[model samples]
Structure formats: C-alpha cells, structure tokens
Target: MLKTAYTLLPALLGMFLLNGCDSSCCMDVPPASNNGLQAPTPVITLDGQPLQGNLTCDPTTNQTITLTAASSDPDGRVVENIWKVDGVESGSVVVCPAPGESKQICLIAVDNDNLENQTCVTLTANNTQPQEPQATPPLPVLTKGDVDGDGGGLYLQCDNTHDTDSLHLYPEDGPFLYGSNDPKDIKEITYNYTYYKADGTIESGPITTTQTEFNEANDQAPGICKKWFHTNNGVATIKVVMTALDDDRQTNTKTYIYNVADGLLVEQP
Candidate 1:
C-alpha cells in the first residue's frame, strides 16, 4: 500500500500529490473565485501539442534532470510543485542510471486547492564505449524538433536504435493521468506495457516515457518514451494494459498483448 499523512500543508505539502488519487482525497479544489476553477493543463497543453520529451544522456557520468511543468497556472496561484515517480511524492533532482541503461521518471504539479496534473519522461544513458583519445576529438551533437499544427492529433514516439545502440523499449503513447483519482480532475488513464524476446525471455511492467535524443529515431517526437524495454536483439511480444475505475473503488483492467519483431512494431492480433 502507498503511504499517507495529514500533510495538507507545510514544507512537505504534497502528500495529496494526486498523481493517482482514489476519490476520498482528490476533491474539487475551489475556484480562484466564485464557483468553477479550471482544470490544470499539462505542459504540452490539454490539446496534445508536442511537448519537448526525451533525453539522450551521457553514458560516462551521473546526470541530473529538472522537472518541467506541463502547464503552470498564471504567474501565482498558491500552488506547489511536487516531484513524483511511479505514483509517489519525492525529492527533486532524481539520480539517473549509469551508462548503458534506460530509466523513466514522472512528476506532478499541485496547487493549495488540492488540485493536480502530471507528466512522465524516459532517460536513456549512452551505450558508447570509450575510444583511444585523439588530439581533436569529435563530440556527438544532439538535435530536436517542434510541434506541427496549431493543434491536432496526439502523437508521441520513443526510439533508441542509433548508430551502434542496442536493445531498448520505446513508449509510443502517454501513460499518465495526474487527477485520474479525483472525480473533478481530468481522468488520465494509466497503462501496463510488456516486452518479450525471441528466446522466450520476457521483460514487463509499467512503461515510463522520456524525451528523445537527437540523431536517434523519433529524435523529434514530443512527449517521453517508455521504459523497461531493453532487449539484446530488439525482438519481442508486446502488451498494453488499460484500466477503468468505478466510484466505489472497483477497477476494470483490460490487457492487450501483441507480438513485435521489429521497431517495437506490433502485429495485428
């Protein structure tokens, strides 16, 4: 079970983070004034524009990433920024994995009114092996892309198959909902994604997403990529789990699994 407290206030005022509230706690925060308070928006906007997601990290040293708000209310609104991972409130500046592994992280922004919103991202540590030192060494230059239309469809891609990169799982959709637990907040759905290899070995669990790196596949896609998808040959079976919740706390989770042998591509079942 998750931890709980009377932390409705204080330096530790994010107990009600609401990343996955279960009803009794996520009540509708009063509006800034008379009646209706607008639901908080993600940094990419509720419209689904490309948010700068994905991060290509240096595999040689420890790195630090600062959380960005999907959507911050006007300049000031008595709100607090709460950093979270896998549905728990945490400290800022998460420690990333050393070279050669992929990791995912999530964060939620909450206000004094008890309202909240969230976003998740993935960080793939470089897998480059050191080469003999050269007088004039070449540095890897990463690039990025921007959102297309004024507003359009929901599009996100995760990629790690680079010049000499190895097995990795990539997130293709958003798997987070900040206020899903609160009846009053946007019910962002949570999911379960799994990957299995050709040899029958399987890697599975909640898929986290992160910004993509330059020169890599979908290096220009918005939103974070998924995690827990590290394979030696890049071949595997895939699954996506979607859940629906009923008022009394009952849940209806549906599991959809597929097979993919290339580009994390799924064959129709």
Candidate 2:
C-alpha cells in the first residue's frame, strides 16, 4: 500500500505542472490588432461648392463646369488626380461635355495605392447667332465731245459734269497718242481728246486740252488737216484749213471775188 501511494503522488504532481504550463502560455498570448490600417476617404467639390458622388448636366444652356476633389489614405500615401467625361478618362485639362442633351463631367482623386475617390458637375450651352449684309456704290458714265463747245483757241474743254474723277481718253483706233495739261486739277477742269480713223483707229494724240475761262469771241481752231467751206455765192469751197503744225505756226486765209457788177468786195467763195 505505501509503494502504490508514492507512485500515485508523482503522477499527480506531473499532471498539475502540465496544467499550469498550458494555462500560463495560453494566457500570455495577445489578441490580433486592428490599429495600423484604415479605409481611404475621398472628398469632392465643384467650382467652389462641395459636391456629392456623381453629377448630371444640361447641354443647351451651360458653358463651363469645373470639378475638384480631396482624397486621403490613413497610411499617409501619395495620390494623383484623374479627370473624366461621362465614364471615359480625359486629358489634364477637361473639355466641356458633349453628345447627350444632358452632360456629365467627372473628376477623380486617387492615392499611390490606386484607391480612388470621384466627383462630377454639369453644364449647358446655347447655339450661336448670324450676321447682317452690307451695301455698295454706283459706277460713273463716260462721254466724248468738246463739252463746252468753246471754239478752237488756247483752252479746250471736254464736258465731264457727270464724271466722278479726272478724265481719261485714248485714240479710238491705231497709233494712239496721249497727253495731260499743266494744271491737271480735275475739279477746275482739264481735257482729253482722241481722233479716230475711218476704221476706228486712233489718229492724233488724245490731247489733253488746257482749261480757261470761256471766250465766245475767240474762234476755236480745228485740229490738223481739218477743212471748212465758205458758201457766200451758194458755191461751197474750202475756206478754212488748219495746219498740221502747232497753233503758233498755223495760218488763216480768206478770199474775195471782184464782180464787175459790184465795186466793193461783193462776195466770198
């Protein structure tokens, strides 16, 4: 009986020591911690106003819409801002919305971890208007002649009362000659003339006759090779002939007939 009791005592002591070791080891181990990591928070705003999740806009009446956001990670991670129109990502600078009557512009803020927070805004635009028409002025008329009909002398005139600016004349046919007067003031007066051949070819210089006060007494001289007839006796003969040379070198001749029936210069032919 003494031997059995001693053996049982050692066994009981072993059981007690094993129980204490298990209890101490289990009790010393700590529960898992949830302190280090946290969810990211993304904040969004527009122009200057805070915004909710997504946005919808009117196409016809809005011109511009701006969106912005603030996003953060509990781990203090760095992030990039991304922009999108509707669902498609866009360039750095956002463009106004398109396609549908209502447009949606979105902006998203993302962390280095690629976690994202997004917000959007809407805008509407109107159509453009048209412009008006302009008016034009009329053209002037041109005519040929000795406008004032001043007889051949120092000053020659071509009428241009209806002309807007200075006058221009060229010989109608071949061998065209052109000239201008000393005082080329169109308002006060200046003249241009052209002589044409039978075939409508230019003959003499389109001589720009000088301007002067009208003198009815001074007979206008004809140009070169011009002829006139005197008809006192009903017989018409060449009475006046203009020389081809300049006026200073020209000459005039008159003829009188002495009829035996009359003493004085009775008639001129």
Candidate 3:
C-alpha cells in the first residue's frame, strides 16, 4: 500500500506541474500601452503673414487667424490631425473679439497630439489720413517757324515764339512776290527736331512749318529758322528748309547750321 501511494503521489505532482505550465501558456494577453504616441508641432500665422512678422489689420473687424499642425509616427500609423482654437476643438483658426476700436489680437495653434504654440499681434488702422494735393507743373515753352508767305514768292520773316500745348506753325510774316491761286502752288514744309532720351532713344518731330506756294519772281528771303530746345529729353538739333514752285517746277532748298542746340547742327559735321 505504501508503494502504491507513492506512485499515485508522483502522478498527482506531475499533473499539478502540467496544469501550472498550461495556466501560464494560455493566460490572456494584457493590452498594449498607447503612451508612445507623439504629438505634432503647430505653426501659426496672421493675415497671410509669417509669425513675428509685420501684420496689418482693421481695428473694426474680427481678424481671421490661421493655424497648421504637422505630425508623423515611426510605426507608419495613420493618425488624424486635430485643430483647436484657444482650448476647444473648434477647428484650425479663430477670430477673437470681432474687430472694433480694438488694436490688439492673439492667435493660437495645436496639433493632433495636443502639442501647441501661439503668437500675439498688434494692428493700427485708421490712425492717419492722406494729405492734400500741391501746385501743378509749369507749361512748356514752344516756338513755331514759317517757310513761306502769302502771294506766291517767299519773302517774309518774323519771330514765332509762343506758349502752346504742342509744336505749332504760323505765317508770322508773309506775302509772296509772285502769287498763284492754284492749289498746287501751295507746299507743305516740315521742320525737323531730333533729340535723344535717357535710354538712348531717338526722338524727332516736325516741330513747325507752313504750306507751299508758286512764284516766278527774284526774291531772297531768310526762309524759315528753327530753334530746338530740350526740357525733358536730351539735347537736339533743328533743321530748317523751304519749298516753293518756280516756273511750274518743284523748287526746294535747305539752310545749313540755321538752327543749333548746344552748338550742334542737325546734320553731322
């Protein structure tokens, strides 16, 4: 009986050891720790301007503020970024105390993990006004030229200086020696003035002149004279010429060095 009892005890001990092993192997697993999650940093701005930057705002309206949060995890886990204003989950940006006589503003930002950052800004609106207009600029001085006179033969001379909006021509002195009523007797004369711009751009113009005429008489007139001047564009030279009908033939002639600007002639020396 003693031997049998010893053998039964050994079996019972073995069974107890197996049960302990099974209990440990089949135990329920404890839940994983979520404390490893990391929160992202938040970025903040005002009026589309960078933080710590110059920001302008109307003191009479609630200014809209923007906040952006970025986050990532090493486990490639997909996490939704959460936004908060002040302390609540009311989305990304917030407009505090609608604008009105207030010149100060505050903005805050938060990320998915509740990480946060904030900025404060001050704005001054309606503080100063614009000033009034001043006096107008002076008008430009103008001078005209006459290449021919009434009647038909060129024989006249006069000063044609005047203040005008643009270049003008006048028959300051006239009365041709031999006159003709035919329209062909009339000629269109041109006085050219050439100048240069600051950027080396050439500017030329038919500053002034008169119509044509026909004449078959001996006459020696000073013709037309030009005085080129510069106000805005660079210095330039003026060219003067006369045109008339002599015995039904086109007669044209020019004067050299008649008009000069800064001691320079219209034609290159």
Positional deviation of residue 212's Cα in model 1 after best superposition, in angstroms: 56
Indicate the worst ten consecutive residues by lDDT in candidate 1: 136-145
Residue 86 alpha-carbon offset, candidate 2, angstroms? 2.4
Per-residue error (Å), model 2, residue 184? 42
C-alpha lDDT of all candidate models, in order: 0.42, 0.37, 0.38
Q: Model 1, 1-269: lDDT tens per residue?
A: 12344443442544344243555654675432322454354452212444467666775556665445555654325366666654567765555567677666665666555666667777677887656432221111111212223432112222221111211112233322222222211112244555666676665445733322222253332333222334334536655554432222233444544444433333223
- Can you write out model 3's per-residue Cα lDDT over 58-118, one digit (the tens) per residue? 4345555454443334434324554443344565554534333223443344444544344
Please report how far candidate 1 places residue 159 from its true position, in Å. 55
Clashing pairs in 3: 60-99, 61-99, 62-99, 150-175, 150-176, 151-179, 186-212, 187-212
Estimate the TM-score of every prediction: 0.30, 0.27, 0.21
How many clashes show up per model?
Answer: 17, 13, 8
Estimate the overall C-alpha local distance difference test score of candidate 2.
Answer: 0.37
lDDT (Cα, tens digit) per residue for candidate 2, span 1-269: 99999989989998775455554565754431222333356555666567654454434443455556666677756377666765778643344455344445666766665655665665333333223322111111122223233422111122222222232332232221111231121222233344433344444434543323223322323211111112222222111111111111221222322221222222234
